[model samples]
Target: MPSADRGVFSLIIINKAGGLIYQREFQAGLRKLSTNDYLVLAGTFHGVHAITRSITPRIPNSQPPPSPATSSPGTAPAVSGYSYPNPGVAVTGIDYLETDKFRLTCFQTLTGTKFLLFTDPMTGNVDTIVQKIYELYADFVMKNPFYQTEMPVRCEAFDRHLGAWLRGRT
Candidate 1:
C-alpha cells in the first residue's frame, strides 16, 4: 500500500466490556444517530461478534488417547497434538463488514480494546491505516498518565496526534 486512502468515513473505539470509549466521523455521509442509538449499536455489534465466534466448527480428534493404565504408573496418558480450541478468547471477532458504499474494518488489540475504522468500500491499504491508528492509540492514549483503563478516552494529545497523522497520510 502506497498511502492511506482519503475516503476515511469514521472511527469508533470499544472497550473490552463493549463500552464506547470513542466515536468520530472523518467525512460526511454516514447518518447521524442519537447518543442512545450509538450505544445500542456498539452493544449489539459486540453481541453479534461473540455469537459468530461461538458458532465456529470444531474438528473432532480422530483417535482417542491411550488409557492411563497403559501408561507409566506415575504419569497420566494424554492425547498428542489434539486439543479443543477455546471459542471465547480464542478467535478475534469479525475483521471487517463491507457494503457497497463503505467498509467497516475492525482491529482488536491484545487488551481487548477494539478500533473500528469505517472507510470507502474501494479503499485499499486499510490494514495499514488501522495499524497506524492503533499505534497512535497506544502511544497517545495508553501511555498517557491521565488515561484510565476501560474508561472513555478523552486525551487531547491522542486526538491531536491521530488527526495529524491521518491527515498527513491522506
Candidate 2:
C-alpha cells in the first residue's frame, strides 16, 4: 500500500450473476458492512444496470416501412425497434458512482465480471488505476492455472502484481 493506492478505500469484485466474490478494504475512512450487505448491493446494482440497458431507446433508421400485422400470412413480421442499425441510446455499461463522501468507480471486464473501486472523493487518476487493475487481473488472475473464472480471486501472483503496481504508481 504505497502512496495514493492508499487513497483507495476498498475494492469489490462481482460476477455477471451479481454474486459478491471478493471484497477488501484498503483504507479506513469508511465503516465496514456485513458480507450479506455487500452481496445485496452487488445484486441490486447489477439489476439496475441491466434495467438501464434494457430501457435504452431504439435508434431511428431510414429503413422502409415494416409490413403490417395484417399482411399476408407468409409475409415477414415487422422488425422490432431494437433492430435499428445505430448504437441506440449508448447503454454501453455502468462506469461509476459519485457521492459526497466517496467516489465508486466501476470497471467491467469483457467477460462481464465487474470491479468496483471505492475511493476518497478527492482521489485522482482513478480511471487510469482501474484500467491498470483490469490489466493485472487479465495477466495474473485470468492467466493463473488454478484460478477459476467468475470465482473469488485467490491468486498470490495477482495480489503481488496489483500491490506492486499500485505502490509504484501511488
Candidate 3:
C-alpha cells in the first residue's frame, strides 16, 4: 500500500444497473480487495443509495384548498413537494461518504452512470476531479465506436487519458 499522503487512492465506476463497470487504483494506500468483493460492494452501495433517495423527505409546498367544482369524484389531486438539496434539480443519491482514512465521492451523470472516486480524507477539489473524469469518459468511452453504453469500460484511450489527467494533477 502507498502512503496516506497521496491525494487519490482509487476509483470505481458502477453502471445504472449497479454493475461494476470500471475499477482502478491510483495509489496504494488502501488495502487490496478481490474483484468479487468490489462487485459486491458496488451492488450493495447501489441498493443503499436507492433507498436513501426514496426515503429523503421533500419540503412541503403551500397551496390554496381545491374548490369543489375543480374536484372530481373518485379522482385524487396531484400533489408534490420541493425536492431536497434543490427545488428544480432531480435527486441524486448520497453525494459522498467520508471516513477517518478516506473519502469516497460519487458523481452520477444525467444518464444515470455513476463515477465513484476515492481520495485521501484531506484532499480538496473533489468535484473538479469528478467532473474531469466525466469529461474523459464522454470523450474516450462514449466516442469509441466499439464501446457499448453501460458496459465495462475497455477503451485504451480512456485508460490513457485518465492516467495522464491524474498524473498531471499530482
lDDT tens string, model 2, 1-170? 34454468888888988888878776655788998899898898888767766765666555755658557778778766444235543454567888877898888777778889988777889998888888888898888888887888888887787777766665
For model 3, how does the per-residue alpha-carbon lDDT over 127-146 read when each residue is reduced to its tens digit?
Answer: 99999999999999999999
Model 3 global lDDT (CA atoms, 0 to 1): 0.86
Model 1 misplacement above 4 A = 1-6, 61-64, 67-77, 80-90
lDDT of each: 0.81, 0.77, 0.86
Clashes of each: 0, 0, 2
Q: Per-residue CA lDDT of candidate 1, range 41-119, in tens?
A: 7888788777876776565567877776788876755766454466345666688999987899988888888888998
Error of 2 at 59 (Å): 4.9
Name the weakest run of 10 consecutive residues (lDDT summed) in model 2.
81-90
Best by lDDT: 3
Off by over 4 Å in 2: 1-6, 59-90
What are the clashing pairs of model 3? 2-28, 2-29
Q: How do the predictions measure up, each by TM-score? A: 0.82, 0.76, 0.86
Best prediction by TM-score? 3
Error of 3 at 105 (Å): 0.7
- Which residue pairs of candidate 2 clash? none
